[model samples]
Target: MALLWWEIFIVVFFVLAVLLPAAVIAFKPQWVFFSRGAKKSNAETINLVRTFMTHYSLPLGMDPLHRQLCLAFMDPFVKTVYSLFAILPDPWMVAICRAVDAFPGNTLRYILHAIIGRTHLIDHVVTEGIKRAGLGRCQWVLLGAGYDNRTYRMAPLRQAYQVATFEVDQEPLQQDKLRRLRKCAAVPPSAYEDVKYVTCNFNTERVQDVLLSANYQPGKRTIFLLEGVSMYLTKEGFAQTLAAIKELCPDDCTLTFDYVDERVINAYNGRTDIVDPPTPPLGSPRSVESTTLDEGMSDCEEGAMVVDKKTAASKKEEVASRASTPLTAEERRYGVQYCSVLERNQTPVTFGLDPSRLETQMAEHGYEIVQHWSPDELAQQFLKWPGGKESKHGGEIVSRACTYFYYCTVRPVRGSAV
Candidate 1:
């Protein structure tokens, strides 16, 4: 009995030895801070994976090159985990992908591609936009580029059309990704040599000036992809970037980006998820409800009653607004988890735009909307097996995530636009 007990104890110890750290990584990310401090890299933790859709979407016949790029950029120690997993049958990868898809991100979209094939749908949109921009006549710029391999991945289109490709990002991160690409891919130098890398710190630098300094031709029609970037920037920063793009590109140039709804911004700030309704200007007639309340009150009571009625109507409006928008720290309980790891790392999500006002907002920057894709629409179009069968659990996942974000394209216009 003693010998049997010892064997069981040893088995349990080994199991925990293997699983405890993994659990810490997945659940207790604060451990990263206590142990070694936040990772010093400016690159977003989700950057590689955001573009690495191909890795998990392998079963769906997605491009495999981005997956290779992701594996290359991973830490050697982390890469070993994937290397070991590679020993399993391919189904394991598909299962992992599905797990990520099913794990709801709520409003913290900085983590997973919760809707599935989101990046790919953006890729498809950009590609189509480039076609419309006219082959060899337009320039393609990727803003806030993070290990983005679109320039290399779209090699055939680039080479055939003589597409002028530029990837703009912070200097250090741009260097890091290039170095990783060199080490990871065994392909010829031509694979990545042609693309220009323009670097800037969005807070302090002008993107338009840098692009021009880097020989970016403003006269050419430009298709700019600013993926996973806006939410990290302040509203002023994003607006300046937009203004710069408008300044740098001529009319009909394209800009593609995704932004979460305002509630996502509130989620990060721990603010009430309720966005106050568009109130009529102060002293605007509070007519119907106020008149109805006055009819029931005596002159002595009328004054106090009117005050109460106004307060009640205000409360009513607030409640009505909050009906669709959930409290951040409460709702799905994601508020507590709202990318807390990213918050500690100093890269917390900070910005979001109201979708209803998006086109009107872009119009302020001399751009007009060309197209938009909600998360559900993207899933409907791309979340299918190559054999044309819709994947399981796609609908519920995407519909819920829909309230979180949108993929939109806007093009520069000559004068005012709406």
Candidate 2:
């Protein structure tokens, strides 16, 4: 029987995920995937990709192949196209591998980095952060973890027999993933004895209750990874989530996650094509001749002619005026406000939790910043592609203009846990 369009698309995607990185490693390793000076060799790239795929193919009470195929196919193409357009600054391939999961293909759940690069970036960061925490033997929690393979892939965690890992998400999604995993990999029960899955709704469910039900103890030192999830939540939700972590885990626990600055969120909101005018305004409707002229212009000139701030703002206001119901007072408050609502009444306001503000918040929450890496600094460290100088338009410039922050923090404010 012939397959459906989406099924064909998914299969083709998996093929590419396996093939593209392999091709890059075999033929154009340096140019296609890595920055100019990255130390990773062709052999390392091939091995890493293969290792990730092998582990990803495993069944840990979840079916991930379908989701993996979807991600393997969609993420790289989207990220590469965006990078080619200079709309994305970070390495697109890395972002895709790090953030894309096998369940819930909702584009809204992932951050810009996730959307434009390989999802493995999160995996890499988390592995590094785990090592930095020096908690090789502690329990680890992967909050909102969707098809995360760290428990299987990371060597340290695999070797630490005493360590336990908890993977949490909404129950329905988790069940769907579990079903898929069972069908695809059929992992032996013994292999997953130390890893547990928990289902909880971050907005309505109590974290403590969920952990206790999953056999997680409040007194154990834990490491938590909350990646590519905060932006989807309201501010209240994020704070409550954090507070729950503090309350549930022992003092020596550590949490790592990423957050976007308000400016970045606003920029993303402004760039969404959903609000684009259906037709040019009556006054500016173009004639055939004008349309021809506009189409004939050089790429540079056409790019330059694209809407500026004033024009964009005017267009937004026009769209707002045309809508039957204008943006709510709540909606107009920016994405952060929406996030604030999710945390319930406990709103911890920081400037995207900038270093200074993060320090203050950590103190109040009985946590301290053990490690912090600014997006700008990370871009500088990882994104080695220098911008094209000869291009008249500045679009080719690889600016470290990221508006997100990633950090790792330890709990209990000052003392080590037994």
Candidate 3:
């Protein structure tokens, strides 16, 4: 049987496209991308990239899907090829990639941290907070957990087998992730015996019901970790969610989460590669739901919105009134929602309040803020980078930017006098 010219060309292309890359990965692996030190010190880097790409793609935002697809395709290839050199064991490499495929947005965030050598900073801070809350032996809840491996990786938690961990998120999303994880990194169920998966939509799930179902007790010292999620929620939605936490947790419970400031959100508005709501109407008050730090004000009292209403209004008016707009294809596709994208295409909406305000709100609701880490302090801690400083992004490094606020709180024991 003689092959036609087109058939011959197709065969050649297929061989080069698929088989060649595989062969290179299996054989001459050292030629693969990434340094040996990087693979060892930051295995989660690739996973972060995968997570970021997944979030960017799954919601069908303004960014070209093709760009995300290309990164997804390239990521596994890099990991596979790199692992053949034994810098990173095959199992670990596969596990990282699988986790990335499981939660792309989070994976990408981790990858960025890895690149910047700041993953340890986050891990350290959270670990300290958890320990300080006296949750070393208590149950831990990871909200929107999304393939986080901390339950297994954090040394203290691993040593305390009495500690039960529950990972909560949407069921379908987790199931799909589990399938991919099984295909790539097939760890035995025994590895996760202390961890349980609770599938629930954050928007609809009854918090009390879910916690009870997960064997959570109200009087126990519990820690809730909410990272990179606040911006996606509406003001009411975010506040109601926190109120539920306060209601369910005992007096010793601690909650830690991050949120962007209004200024950062405004700066990021209309940028491609993000998911945000339409630019809010001019002079619109920042949501009262957020927490801010005001030196002269009592906790919970409203402070100035991080972004001045006049300023935001003027920018919106300018964008709206433009005769020849230069919005990107993604901005056009996603419309106003694209404004939500923050640094590197992640969501950047701030709920409009600061840490002090949140502390005040929590106090009223029976929770008291114990510690607050401002962006300046975090920047000083993380950005020192051994001997010297690195270039700044928009003169607002992650450590110094007013983009996020993190706090720890403990609920008062019932019947205790204020």
Predictions in order: lDDT: 0.59, 0.45, 0.44
**Residue pairs that clash (backbone atoms under 3 angstroms), model 1:** none
Write the candidate numbers in order of decreasing TM-score.
1, 3, 2
Model 2 scores a TM of 0.49
Q: Give the candidate number with the greatest lDDT.
A: 1
Q: Which stretches of candidate 3 lie over 4 Å from their true place?
A: 1-122, 129-136, 159-161, 184-188, 266-352, 355-358, 361-365, 386-418
Best candidate, TM-score: 1
The C-alpha TM-scores of every prediction are 0.74, 0.49, 0.51
lDDT of 3 at 109: 21
Instruction: Write the residue-wise lDDT of candidate 3 on 1-418 in tens digits.
Output: 3568889987886566545643543333233433233321122233433333222211211123322322332345554543332233434443443343223232122223222223334455456545544434466777876545555445345444355677777676456445544443324344455577887666666665787787877766566776555656667766666766767764555566655433234434533453333444457744323322223222221111123446444433332322112234432332222233222233334454334245555566565543344444445444332322463332233222222333333344355433
